[model samples]
Target: MKTRSGKGNRVGLAVLGLVLLAVGGLAIARALGSFGDAAAREPVVDAGARSFAATTPWFWPVVAAVGIVIGLIGLAWLLALLRVDRPRRLRLESGTTGVTEVDAHPASEALAEQVSTYPEVRRAHAVLRGPSDDPHLDIGVSAEEPADLGALVTRLHDEAVPDLRTTLGLRRLPAMVRLNLTGGRRTRPVH
Candidate 1:
């Protein structure tokens, strides 16, 4: 979801931020007598605005409607963030013999555990995405700060990824690995 809507979210946030900054800057300018002391003391809506609002009965209703629409849009965006499209079960085999269905979550978890056991690894995670037939794997690994990143990455490409593909009976399993370095410091004996 973030991948798809990332650009839109960024643009929207940028526009909203700019608008807010302009409003806040105006308020601060008024407070500092950049506009006037009277402007600072007066309500946000001036006499002309207030008179127009009073004369036009639809003004308050329009404002209320706009607020509701914005609120609903924000609620939708938040709900979209919570939505997951991950495939729960993966079809390992669907041959002339029979169908073999495997729970993707457990399989991915086991893979993560396997990777976590590697030397210098602190923690790991794995997620399976896309359709049941053809799945995509996303792996995250956190290693000690002093870990040999080159060796770990090489192992992932040479050993772990191929092993997973072989286990899942996949010709090619597209895997993305995200590596992080843990902030933990190994204790040293003070001389």
Candidate 2:
């Protein structure tokens, strides 16, 4: 849960501390050795001088530590990007009583059960509209065949408004049963 900038700062500080420790340790060792006076110590002195002028063994450790810190910073940045880029997941369920698995029921079944009680609606379907409205029921009806479209629309509006209000206890229904007419074709399976 740490932010990328915070993670980077922590890693940078840790690496800097380690590099400082290594360099300080080497300098202290050289300074201590220089205090001794002896001809036999000449090579040691020369080596220490050369090491001070040139890169020490600690150089690679510092580089590796810095590399690790940079890698960690990059990794944290990538994770933050992925979190923002991922799509959200949605979960839907019916608010009706005794309907445990609304998703499992076909759209036709849901429409028939919930909206078809009115004489106007002949067929109904539950549909999920992604990035549009929330989950809703779409109904298909026939005015020419045994039902009237105006009456059906009115009946559906009346029943749906109150049914959804009382059942879901929502101030307003999020979706409505959209009615369509097709000449006697069997309603497509809701799933």
Candidate 3:
């Protein structure tokens, strides 16, 4: 069974994209007179619904309430997307100090820059995930060439991780490294 990690966001965004594309295409088609001149003359909400909304005293208020509810839902969704898994300024586990904190984004950015300068590495990006006590280091490294992948990963784990741990004042930090080997023009093999 496949685990669902960020799949919902992917699927939701994909469906929203398709819907938005369709709506845009329809609007463009209408603008180009694909639906003929009669479409522009048509009532947007139809005559029957318009008449009911006009006659009923509570219709407009109900519609307004529903619109507000939808607006609130949309706002909540936006907030959730912006929310992070952990705090931006992480508190360090100081042995004999009153308080100590580190900004996660800056620390990750520094680590990424350091890794990118490593031998056989083309580029790197790092993100700190999870809580401060048990944080996960997600590093994406692009290798200069395929042959250097093994040595690059080994060097990254042995040297870079420990160095980051020391900087963060942590004893252990679990890292998840994603390595991508940069490929050039491929030579055709004769069978």
lDDT of each: 0.89, 0.54, 0.82
**Segments in model 2 whose C-alpha atoms lie over 4 Å from true places:** 1-112, 128-146, 184-191
Q: Candidates ranked by TM-score, best first?
A: 1, 3, 2
Worst 10 contiguous positions by lDDT, candidate 2 = 84-93
If both were scored by lDDT, which would come out higher, candidate 1 or candidate 3? 1
Q: Over the stretch 85-188, how does candidate 3's per-residue lDDT look in tens digits? A: 75487678556657788898988899999998887677899998887666778899887655567778788889888888889888788999998878754689
lDDT of 3: 0.82
Misplaced by over 4 Å in model 1 are 1-4, 36-43, 46-52, 55-61, 82-85, 91-101, 119-122, 130-134, 143-151, 180-191
Q: 49-125, model 2: which lDDT tens digit per residue?
A: 67765667777788789999989988986676555321132233446553333232343355457765555455455
Q: For candidate 3, list the clashing residue pairs, or say none.
A: none
Please tell me which predicted candidate would have the highest lDDT against the true structure. 1
lDDT of 1 by residue, 1-191 (tens): 45758788788889999999999998889888888888778788779988998999899999999999999999998887677767889898898999998898988888899999999999999998888898888999999888899999999889888888888888888999999998778589999
lDDT comparing candidate 1 with the true structure:
0.89
- In candidate 3, what residue range of length 10 has the lowest lDDT sum? 1-10
**Which prediction has the highest TM-score against the true structure?**
1
Task: Report the lDDT of model 1 for residue 56.
Answer: 100
Instruction: Report how far residue 79 has shifted in candidate 3, in Å.
Output: 3.8
**How many times do residue backbones clash in model 2?**
1
Question: What is model 1's C-alpha RMSD?
Answer: 4.5
